[model samples]
Target: MAVFSVIKLSELEGAKRIDAEYYDPEYLEVKQKLLKKKFVYFKNLVKEIIHPKEIKREYEEEKQDYLFLLAQNVRPLMFDLSEKKFISEEKAKLMPKNLLEKGDILFVRSGNVGDLTVYTGEPKKIIASSDLLIAKPTFKFSYYLGVFLTTNYGQKILIRGIYSGLQPHIAPSYIKTIPIPILPEEIIRRTEILYLKAQNLLKQSESLYSQAESLLLEELGLKDFKPRYKKTYTAKLSDTFSAYRIDAEYFQPVYEEILSTVSKKHRIEFLKKIFDFRRGIFISTDYYTEEKTSRPYIRIKELTGKTGIDESKIIYIKDNYPIDEANSLQENDIVIAIIGDTIGKTNRIYKELSGGFCSNNTGRLRIKKELNKEIIPEYAEILFQSVIIQSQIEKKKTQTGQPKISDKEIKSILIPILPLSTQQQIASLVQKSHETRKKAKELLEIAKKAIEIAIEKNEKEALDYISKSEEK
Candidate 1:
């Protein structure tokens, strides 16, 4: 206290006379208690996994390893572009090393930072971009670490440590130093249970997509479809064509090869029978409305992978708007993205979107009404999403800073036609898969909400129901 100052104030140059006490005993005690609650520990407890092979010091040409890559968002992505041989000297410089191994936990290091994903397949021989940290735990804490990182406490530590600025960045070292409180064994077990449920739901969605693709392939009688273009071979081009002067990527021979393959199998030509397939009209920002009594406008941002349509982000239209002016989405109509890297992505309007309006970027497809087509829109959606179709899109993708698929390209796309009965069977499986996916999403929401409530109120009061059940 100032009244009982042990040291003279005149000795301190910056010191000023104060009537108030220098310190409060009660306040100091409370501060000490809070400081004790701070959990700080060394990061070396968690281990990092590097590529198994060491980089070559010398090279016949500049050598590279499996590409080192990282996911940029909540969704992790891998680029599989190994087919084309003969990398350019300039292009080769940008190539990465460090191929990813299955079951390895991927951690983002920069940009849209701090997302995690566990790899499962043999994407071996591929590289990871420098913006990632692959963490492998010494203890059985990997699963718990994942759950905690996604939890409020984990996110709190992550967010608090972030160096705030424009294009906010969190250093990998900072993320590694984050304190993960030791959770109860019961809580850990429950977290694992929730994790597994979510994993199973994802797997089911993937399997459903696979089944639908197989059905389409069999229906088209091209069950064993393979394109003529070989990744190793250098494609020949005629000098006569001016377009040939451009880069080899512009001439997506793979797209044509696929069209040729389907043409051989189908009894009827899909191109001839179809009425129209083209990109939608792009509307300027001035035309958009903030609110309306009628339909909501859809955008590519609204799209969720495998989740289909989401209406929460939609914009409203005016009631006085003319039907012709309104961007109406009809029943069973297919919506496909036309611009940017996500081009060729497709979704079908089902019961949920019985009547809605999509964005200009979303291409609309209405099969000829007279076709009386029993062809499930879901089935067609599955076909477009198949690896076979996606491979072609990648091969043909015109990269202008960013990769994109042309409207002309999707218009000429081909699919195999199956018996109506077989199509129906596959559609049934898709419907069931959708139901499971929806339920899985709901359960995940409940689990997250429970965790939020637990953080606000102590675990005992928040999870009292679960605790009582465990006692029984």
Candidate 2:
């Protein structure tokens, strides 16, 4: 069967867009349904939609007076404040309008178009990169608007408006023309409630992780410790020969400081003593397929800790594709990026991601059964993310064209050993953080589904779905 769409001459003239995607039948149907109910241009609902002015600035890592958010900081329906770059207050003053406030909606305009997130009133003063389009909604319930934009129907319309050539792009003018349905007040209220609840849960998750980090630092007596850099350092010729060819970065004072601090506070043990490193499977590109299956092939990009594992982004292989059972992920396994810019980044496998195929560029750290009683996987994961182990991993990384750490180097990385009781306390906090984040995601999905149901069916049906989902 062939699908056809008939468009009127006047409609084409009105849109001034000759691209077939701009007039896709599915988008037209969604538009018609929205128009059947109360609808208004997106520009009318928002006070203004604008992009930030480009700032000529440099990152001030040590003196981080002002925080800056890049496109990577904006995840779906959430803002990832971790690993943020900062600038001095003097530099931030140059562009005051870029400062974000509560209830403001952010949309990605370039590279990863159509990605959206709302600033949920955290970090009183922060600025966003120029790649983000900031929409300041005049309506009280902006969360409802944010939820709608992230849904399948909303994403399709936004994506269809994209102009692809050198790069995929969406302009503010195109975003202004998108239609927004004026949903029932009750439905909007329910969405706002759920959205706020999710935000609260996410905050709890952040706080729990912070508590766990604090415990680790306090235990190691590094709560107020700072690395001091010296202009000159001495290293013996024999030492350099034994460690192989030397780079100035490999002998940084900060690396030694981190190592010395950990050794002083706790008994240090090599990673091989507690966990065995296993490399992920490598499948040739010729074997790749679009066939949908229960198995997901996870790449480095999909290993984001903040978003967990995005099932939507995973590429599937054919059902008959050979899978190495030994390389398959298991619950509580720690997946680390052993190659490229993502080196040292880690994501602990949860129940939902078990049985997925890991990418070749990654490595898994499975707890040694004999030493499992001494080390907790959750605690080890947090340690890997901490400054102590990360600095060591950074020093050991070999940079050719792309940076990579060998499995031998990974096994040789030292880990600080804390008391089992202390490990349990930290593990419990981290586990709760993951659970809270899961709850936050569940609530956010309910809100998105409710908006979709309301648009495709009726307001009453959407409300019923929300009620039933909440019961579950």
Candidate 3:
């Protein structure tokens, strides 16, 4: 179906956009409704907008680090810390403008216009990447404005603000011209309160996940364990004269240190003894689409640590898949990244991700019938993510060309068998963590709906709506 819009010359924007989409009737309708109430320009709502910069960074370990946030970390209503990277404190201090404070809004100026999220986490802890437009809002305006812009009317106005060119981008100069509809002061105050509640819930969620990891490591006696990494380590001539080996990196002592620690605590079992493999099938890039209505294609990068897909980075399969292939992943299927940037990453398919198609670089692991009674999939994913398994992957994976874990090496990979009760306890905490995060998102949603109702109907009705939503 084709859609057309006719714009009158007198009604055209001063910048003179004749693009058919610029005159979208829906946008025109929203423009009228927004003007019906008292409105102010978006620029008047913020303190200052910080543009992106190219910052030189030095990566560091998790404990001695400040988080480095990429554009993908800025989710719609929250930041997804499932996958994380870090920078040294020395580098973090040098570029303070890049560091995000709580209540600051992280806006995407290009690529994904109108997409932004308020930071509800700790102040000055996370540093955003160069792709984000970090805006420090006045008072609690962050919560009110952030939710409002994501509303249906707000999104359309942002679309109209896009300066179309070879690569469409939104400029701060253009944003200054965007209108923001104002609601009651009390309504804004309540929205701010809701965001704070959401933030606290998210903090609780992260703490639960950490507790789960700590429990697993504690049970395995790897708690408070730090493997030594020497500047220069030596190996005997006989040890270096293996059939295929001349590489120095292959003989790193850190690998041995980790192995020795785990072996002393528990007997290690070869993964091949307990699991069967289901490798994903290859599909051409021609089948990929940005049209999200199509079936999503899950690659290794799409695997979030929370056992879910990163929808912002996810792509859809435009064409019908081959009829004979059993490429579809089912709920709770444990998947692992076997190649490229995310090699060694493992997660289970959540209920929402059941029907998604997996890419060739990823492989699914199913516990053999004999071993299924002993191991839980959730527990397996947690074990795979730990340094116990990751260290082995680092020692075995090819590093010369494309980084990968070989099939032969994977079969021989080590696994620790923990007590069944301990595994269930760890898995239960992880499930609770994921649930708490959802509740946080739900609160943000109530704010969004309230904003919509206030604009469409009246503030009295909207306040009643919030009151009723709270009662429920």
Candidate 3 steric clashes: 0
Q: What is the lDDT of residue 449 in candidate 1?
A: 44
What TM-score does each of the candidates earn? 0.61, 0.90, 0.80
**Cα lDDT tens digits for candidate 2, 1-472:** 5677788888994766887777889888877776787888889888999799887557655647778878767777877665778887877888888888888999987877877988877876788879788999998888888888888878877887899878888999988888888889999999989999998998899889889989988897777888776678877788789888487777777888878877887999888988878988887766666665666677887777644555545777666777778888888888888998978888788777787777899998899889889988779878888888888888999989999998888998988899999999999999999899889989999999998898888999999999999999
Q: Could you tell me the TM-score of candidate 2? A: 0.90
In the range 113-161, model 3's lDDT, one tens digit per residue, is: 7778888667357878777888787745778888888777877887787
Question: Which residue segments of model 3 deviate by more than 4 Å?
Answer: 1-38, 62-72, 82-96, 99-102, 108-115, 121-129, 152-170, 234-246, 281-296, 306-308, 311-325, 400-402, 453-465
Q: Sorted on lDDT, highest at the top, how do the candidates line up?
A: 2, 3, 1
Model 1, position 35, has a per-residue lDDT of 36
Enumerate residue pairs that collide in model 1. 66-127, 67-127, 67-128, 68-127, 68-128, 68-129, 69-128, 69-129, 220-416
Every candidate's lDDT: 0.54, 0.83, 0.78
Worst 10 residues of 3 by lDDT: 56-65
Q: 1 or 2: which has the higher lDDT?
A: 2
Winning candidate number (lDDT):
2
Q: After aligning candidate 1 to the native by TM-score, how far in Å is the CA of 43 from where it should be?
A: 3.7
